[model samples]
Target chain A: MRATIIHKPGDIRIEDVPEPKILRPTDAIIRTAATCVCGSDLWDYRGINPVDEPHPMGHEYVGVVEEVGGEVTSVKPGQFVVGSFATSDNTCPNCRNGYQSSCVHREFMSTCQAEYIRVPTADGTLVATPDQPADDLIPSLLTLSDVMGTGWYAAVAAEVQPGSTVVVVGDGAVGLSGVIAAKELGAERVIAMSRHASRQKLATEFGATDIVTERGDEGIARVKELTGGIGADSVLECVGTQESMLQALRSTRPGGNVGFVGVPHGVAIDGQELFFSHVGLRGGPAPVRRFLPDLIDRVLDGRIDPGKVFDLTLPLDEVAEGYRAMDERRAIKALLRP
Target chain B: MRATIIHKPGDIRIEDVPEPKILRPTDAIIRTAATCVCGSDLWDYRGINPVDEPHPMGHEYVGVVEEVGGEVTSVKPGQFVVGSFATSDNTCPNCRNGYQSSCVHREFMSTCQAEYIRVPTADGTLVATPDQPADDLIPSLLTLSDVMGTGWYAAVAAEVQPGSTVVVVGDGAVGLSGVIAAKELGAERVIAMSRHASRQKLATEFGATDIVTERGDEGIARVKELTGGIGADSVLECVGTQESMLQALRSTRPGGNVGFVGVPHGVAIDGQELFFSHVGLRGGPAPVRRFLPDLIDRVLDGRIDPGKVFDLTLPLDEVAEGYRAMDERRAIKALLRP
Candidate 1:
């Protein structure tokens, strides 16, 4: 099975790895149909997050279940399934409370940029599609596993609702997906923060009513100006940087909310500023699984097509090029076919 | 008129000051019946918050309207009233959305330690009781102006739902009041983290179901152990220290909420910890005015007595002693009568 691995920062390879086998009673083996590079992967690829040894990459995936352990009941062989980046025993108290990402028995599923993978807590982690998705629908279905579901969580955490005016910070795949999520969640006005023409075009098509190319104070000013100097009702932070976080917080009105989905890096927030701003901040590793059922339905019904975020695609053997495309910003996201 | 003044750290004196006059069309002069030394006041007295010049200090007050400018309508002369430490024009979008403390035209009402103090935004910041309260309720009504309202905001921010298990991270007047607020909000269990016996006693009296004398990690562990190793449904961060904030964040169950009202001092939170915690954090200068009407009703109707927090009382001339008592921990709060 060909899989993506990083030997070091800027060093990528595709090698034949052993096929996955069920290791837990709740495990399920899936033959990967599609997977993609993620923003977080850049953390390791850029050496910001040290890769001490050669390691497999990728966490998002949509696949066909090849086998399941005896304890796995919800999903079975031949089922087309989507699962979040993290695996969880859905019966845990945390899972029951819609925080499956933080489930007490959770196991983070990584290294699925491969031909096959083993998913633990299969019964609780995998959601089967009503039917096998058409080839055209696979890319969209793939996003439900992470990026799309994450965007939906961002909107939900930000409390986006009907008639809401929302601002999305970042123009990555997740940010673009958030535009769609906000629209699907009934936000009346979705503002996308972007400077790239391609990303802006996709953002507009995904339901962004406005775009602000400025960064930092200027970006915030642009948002406030557009919002009549009051700021947005809700702000989605899809990029986890100090500047992005502060911009998101400052972009929300005093009584509004900011939902951040980016994996924060070097972010330290002043409590006093947050307090005085009176903006409610809620985000983390999104409880992506919580919104899987609803989002999967939306994708299946053609109410949304978040797959448009993938601007490039390649075979599993070209995983290195896929990573390169996204790393160099040549592609919004690169989908890999196994 | 006499007022409390701090020229420097530990330098307190009762000074003869000019009588306050209505300074704004929306302002009113109030003959303060009760004022108290707040924990924040000690910040200036202790030299943490420098007092470069001799300045009168007091914000919390329950009094009778002595005079009103032309624009003052909701509150009139001779009306008994309780106003929050921060005065706000409640018509602002923030106020209309229930965040009066963050109102666009908000003003901090200082120097109420004197016999008469001018309150801005009188029509919005001040909430009159249903009727003049008897002597017994004065202390509780005074708290409505600050500490009590702040505690209630913490509980509300933590989203204290019916049957929630709540943990309060401070045992000061605000925290003790939070216990009462949590109970009032229908929490099944209220845990107060306090080292002092006296403060713990007050917390228990205020409806604390449990008390943990531990601090830092041990305290969080105790809270987790009490909740079967998962953590509480809500945690009120009543102290604005980094340790208290982290403890509060760690003590809440994933998907749980934390409402903090501590005037944060040197607090910087790690974005990754907050993100991974999957807990909601909200705090700051509380929207005290938003809760004033209901709080006043609660106090006047004799449903709750938050005023018991005041353990020492002094006349305006002995204001120095009031500061000393609280500074030395000899009193939970010191009430001043002018």
Candidate 2:
């Protein structure tokens, strides 16, 4: 089976690797139907996150369950399924509290770019569609495995209400998806912060009522200008840099919330600054498993179409080009089919 | 009139200061009936928060309205009233959103240690009691101006819900007051992290179901053990140090919240650590004005006796001793009668 491997920074290869098998009683093996590149993957590819040795890549996927260990009763072989980047046992206190990404027996799914992958804690991590989804629906369904669900969590974490004014602080696929999530959650006004014309168009299609191309202080000022001089009711931080984080925090009104989904890198929030801001902050790896069921329904019902985020598609053999295109800012996201 | 002044760190004095007069049409003059030394005051007293020059001290007080400016109609002269240390117009966007402390027209009361003090935004900052209370209720009522209200904000910001398991990481008056708040908010188990015997006793009286004496890692571990190894639902961070902040964050379960109220002196939060912890963080100068009315009612109803935190009392003329007693930790808090 072919798998995506990163030998070092700026080095990605499609190498033939042994197919994954059910390694635990709670695991299930799935034949990959679709997988994609993520912004976080660039952390390693760009040498920002050191790569000590070559390793399997990818954590998002939608596939057909090829086999399941005895203990996995909720999902069975031959079922078309979607699973989160982080696997969970679901019954743990954290999982029960809607933080499945923090489940006590959690295992983050890697090597999903391979032809076949094993999903641990299958019962809790994988949600099967009602039936085999149409080929056109696969891209949207595949997103439920990570990005779309993550976007939904961002909205929920920010406590976006029916009358909320939301600001999305990223232009990547996740940010565009967040626009959809905010609108679905009944946000009356969704502002997408993007200078890229292509991403801006997609964000508008996904329900962004406005766009602020400014960055830093000017960006904060622009948001405040649009929000009656205070700021938005909620801000979804999809980019994890210090600048993006500050943008999200400062663009929210006093008593508002910043749901930061971007994994922070080198960001140190000043305690005194945050205290005086009076803005609530909650961020982490999105508990995608917790939102899979609801998001799947929304996708199936055609209430949302997040697949538009995938502008470039290629065969699994072209995984390297996919990474390059995304890293060089030529593509919002690249979808690879095995 | 006599007022408490801090000439420098460790140098507190009772000085003859001119009586306060309404400086704003929204101001009202109050004859101080009771005031107290707060834990935050010690920051200035200990040189942690620099006392640049001789300045008035005290922000907590219960008093009788001496006079009202032309625009101050909600409070009348001679009426007993309670006003938060952070005054608010209550009509601003932030105030309307229940973050009165961040109101557009906000002021911090700093002269309340004097015999007579002026309160700005009187209509919104001062809440009049239905009737004058007995002298015995003075201490508790005085706390509503700051400590008690701050504690309530901690609980509220921490999202202390019915049946929650709460951990309070401070034993000062505000933290002791937090124990009461957690109980009143329907927490099933309230853990007070305190090593002081006297404070532990007061915490127990205020409804702490358990006490953890450990600090740092041991404290986090003990709290985890008490909370079924997952951590508490809500952690109130009342002592604003880096250690206390980390303790509060580590002791809360994923999806739980940490509401920090102590004015942070030198604290910086690592974004990565906090992100992976999955704990929501919201802190600031307590929006005391938001919780003033309810806290006043709780004190007046005798349902909560936060006044018990005042283990020592002094006349306004001996205000230096009041500061010294609290600074030495010889008293939980000091109530000053003018």
Best candidate, DockQ: 2
Q: Score the docking of each candidate (DockQ).
A: 0.83, 0.93
Let me know the TM-score candidate 2 reaches against the reference structure.
Answer: 0.99
The clash numbers for all candidates, in the given order, read: 0, 0
- Give candidate 2 misplaced runs (Cα > 4 Å): none
Tell how far residue A31 is off in model 1, in angstroms: 0.7
For model 1 the local lDDT of residue A28 reads 97
lDDT (10s digit) by residue, model 2, range B163-184: 9999999999999999999999
Give candidate 1 regions above 4 Å deviation. none
- What TM-score fits each model? 0.99, 0.99
Per-residue lDDT over A43-96 for candidate 1, one digit per residue giving the tens place of the 0 to 100 score? 999999999999999999999999999888999899999999998888889998
